[model samples]
Target: MTLAKSSELGITHLPDHTELPESDGTFVKNFQEHPQSLLLTDSITDVLQQLHPDHQFAIGQDCGIYWRLTEPPEKGAEAPDWFYVPNVPPMLNGKFRRSYVLWQEYVAPLIVLEFVSGDGSEERDKTPLTGKFWVYEQAIRVPFYGIYEFSKASVEVYHLVDGKYQLLPANERGHYSIPPMGVELGIWQGQYKNMTAPWLRWWDTQGNLLLSSDEKSQQLTSQLEEVSSQLEQEQEKAERLAEKLRQMGIDPDQL
Candidate 1:
C-alpha cells in the first residue's frame, strides 16, 4: 500500500514492510506453483548460505516486491514465483518481512524466477510500468530473470546488459551460469516429493546437480549401507582365509 499519508495535512512517510498488504487477493494459478517454489528454494539454500556467510540474504516465494507507490499498494508490486536478494537480512528488526520494499531497501534482487502456468504471456509481457517483464527489467532491474515452463520442460533466462534484457545462451551442459552464486540454472527430470516431472532446478557451474536436504540425507544413508555391506563381505572373506590356514596345519593367529 501507499506510504503512511496525511490528506488533511500535507505529509507522507514511506511505509515499511509492516504497513503493506502481503497479498493481492488472487489465487495461485495452479497447484504446481507451491511445490515448484519450494523445490527451487530447498535446493539452493546451501549455495546461498555459503555465498552469504553472515546469513544476510533473503529468498522470497510468491512474495511481493514493491517498486513504486500506488493507490492500492499491491498494484505497485510484482510477486515472482521465486527471487533471491543478496546481502539483506532474512528478517527486518527481528520480525519477518511481509513484503520487500525497494524504496526502503535499495538493493535489488539478484534474480527473479517466474513459473509459467498458462501460455507464458504474463511472464514475458514487456508493457511499460505494468508488464511483468518491463517491471522486472526496467523498474526492479533484476539482473537475471527466468521464465520456466514445466510442461515444456524448458526455461528461458534473460540477463540484463547495458540497460536491456539479453537472452542468455546455455553453456555446453545446457545450463545458465549464475556466476555470483557459482551455480547454474537448468531443468531436471526427476522425482521430488514423490512427483516425477521436469523441475526447474539448480546446478553447480561444473554441471553438478544441486541436491536438496532430503536428497543429501538419502545419499548419506545409501553410502553408509554400502560401506556396511563391504565390511561384512571383508569379514566373511577373512574368516574363510582363517579356516583355510588352520586346515593347512598353520596357526591362523600366528600370522
Candidate 2:
C-alpha cells in the first residue's frame, strides 16, 4: 500500500546519528502471584532493551502515549509485557517502578516487543485494545511491534509507516531491520544462557552479531593478547638474527 502523506501521518522520524534494570526481585514477587505470566513478561523487558538500545524500555510499564480513552490507565500500571516510550532516559531505578511514569519523561518507546506466555502464541500475542489487523497501529502507536513465541521459535516484526504498522520483509536469514535503532532483529538458532533453540540476539551496524557485553570484552582482550604475543615472537626472532650477525663480527646495527 502507498504510504500516507507526512502531514496525514504526523510521524517525525528521528535520525540514528543522534542516539539496565534488575527485575529479579519483582520477578519473584510476580512469580508467586503469576509464574507463567511473569516469565513472558520478564523476557519482554530483556528483549526490548536488546532490540532498541537507543530507547528506554520497560515491561509491565505504563506508557505515556496519548490514550484516546476517556483517561489514561492507572498512573503506576502493571500493563503489557513490554512497552517503549522514546526520547526517555536509559537508566532504571534500583527498585521497582510504578508503571512507566511517562509524565516525568515526556516520551515513550518507539517500539514494543511482547512474548507469548502460553495458550498458543497466536492468542498470547494479541492486544485487543488495539485493532486486530493493526494493533500497534491503533492502540500502542509504537513505531514497531514484534511478537515472539519462545517454544516455536517464531517471530513477527512490524514497522510504522503512513500511520500504520507495516510487516517488515525478512531476508534469507529470517531477519528484519529498524531504521531508528540502526540494527537488525532475527531468530538466532542456537543456545543462550544454556537454553537450546533459536533466541533473539542483537546485531551491530555492520550486521555482525553483537556479542554480549562480556563476549565483546573477552573478544577484544583475546585479540589484544594475540597481537602482543605475535609482537613478542617477532622481536625475539629479530634479536636472535641480530645476535647471530654480531657473533659473525658483522656490524648488525649498520646492517
Candidate 3:
C-alpha cells in the first residue's frame, strides 16, 4: 500500500510532544511481568529500530494508554498490546517509558496490535475480550488494527474506512497490508524463539519481509562459522601438501 491511497493524513497536524505521569512505576512493572507479550513486543521493537533507527517515532510496548473517553481514571480503557506514533520520538529525549499520556499525545496510534490471549481459561485462552477493538477503531479512530492468534498462528488486519473498521483480506502470501503503518502484518510459518508458529512478522510496504534482530544475528553467525570451517579446511590441506613435499625430499619453504 502507498500514501497515494490516503486522504490528508492527520499525523502532521498533531503536536509531536508527549507527557508522562508523576512517578507511577507500577505500570512498567506490570507490563514486564507478562511474558507472553514478549514475542510480539520484541518483534515490534526490532521493526521500529530498522524503520526509524534514530528513535524518530513514539512507540508503546504493552504500556499504559490514555483513551479518548471522559471516564473516571480507573474506568478508562487501557493501552494496546503494542502501538506506535510514527511522527514522534522513539523515546522521550533518549529515554524509555512506562506509560503513555493521551493529553500529551494528541494523535492516535498509526497501528495497534492485540495478541489474542485474554483469559487464563484454556490452552487457547478463549476468554471473551474484543470490546477493546471497537473502542480503538471506532471510538479512538486508530487507523489500523492487527489481531494475531499466537496459538493458532493467524492474523486478521483491519483498516478504518469511512469511520468503519473494514477487515482486509490476506494477500497471495497470507499477509494483510496496513496502509497506515507502511508495512504489512503477516504470519510467517517459521521458527522463532524455538517455537514454530505463524509468527507475527513485519514486511515492508512493498511486501518484502523485514528481518528480526534475532533472525539477522542467526544469519550472520551462520555465515561467520561457515567461513571459519572453510579456513580450517584450507589450513589442513596446506599442511598435508607441505608434509608430502618434505617426504619427496624437498623443503617446500626453501624451494
Candidate 4:
C-alpha cells in the first residue's frame, strides 16, 4: 500500500481520502473506548451545530488522520479516539470520508482526544515522527490535545502555543476551557448508556453541563409533564370557585 509515485508519473501527486487505508487491522484496546467516543460525540453535537450553522464540520470517532505518506499508508495516519474538525463538510465530494487526508484537506482538527488505554506512555510520548504527542503538536499542529484516562478519572489538555504544547490550567470548576469552541472539557462521574463510571464530557463556559440528545429529550419530557400537572390543578380550582358561586345562588356562568 504505497503512495502513488510522483517521480514515475513525472508530476507531483497526493492521494485523497478515498485512496487511503481506513484501518490498520488493530483491535480496539478496551471495551470502554467505543462508549466513551459516543458520549463525547453525542454531548457536543449541539454545540457543533450551533457553531457551524452551515453544517460544515466533521466529528471523527476512531478515524485515521493521514499526516504523511508511508510504505503502509496506515502508518502515516494517527487515529485519535475522538476528534473534531470545524469548517470542513461532514462529507467529501458527496461521499462520507473514509479517512481524513491532511494533505488534501489542509485543515487540522480543532481538537484531538486520545483515551489512555494502557500506562498512558503512548499518548504522552514526545519522540519525533512516531510519537502521538509529537505527531499532533509538531506535524499536525492541532490546537488542542486531550489525554483522558478513565481509570484515573482524569483528563489533561494541552494548548499549542508558540510551536509547543502548554498544559492548560483547570478553571474554578476544574474544567479546561476551549475558548474557541465556547465549551469546557472535563470528567463527569455518572452513568451513560448504562455504564456507570467517570466519563469525559463537555460543558459550556458558564459551567453548565452540555446534555446529550437523550438527556435533552428526558429534560423536555419532564418539563412537559410538570406543566400538564399544573394546568390540571388550575382547572380544578376554577371548578371549585364556580360551585361556590352556584351555592350562593349567583349565576356563575353569567358572571
Instruction: Say which candidate scores most in lDDT.
Output: 4
| Model 1: per-residue Cα lDDT over 41-113, one tens digit each | 9999988889888999999998899987776778889999899999998998999999999988889999999
For candidate 3, give the lDDT of residue 173. Answer: 72
What are the per-residue Cα lDDT tens digits for candidate 3 across 125-244? 222222566567555677887777766777777788898778898887778876645667787777666666666777877877776668778889999999999999999999999999
Candidate 4 residue pairs in backbone clash: none
lDDT of 4 at 139: 93
Candidate 4 lDDT, tens digit per residue, 88-206? 98999999999999878888999999999888999999998889999999999999999999889999999999999999999999999999899999999988888899999999999
My TM-score estimates for the predictions, one after another, are 0.94, 0.59, 0.68, 0.91
Residue 200 deviation, candidate 2, in Å?
Answer: 0.9
Better of 3 and 4 by lDDT: 4
TM-score of 3: 0.68
Q: For candidate 2, which ten residues in a row score worst on lDDT?
A: 14-23
Q: lDDT of each structure? A: 0.90, 0.52, 0.62, 0.91
TM-score: the better of candidates 2 and 4: 4
Ranked by TM-score, the better of candidates 1 and 4 is 1
Q: Which run of 10 residues does model 1 get worst, by summed lDDT? A: 1-10
Best by TM-score: 1
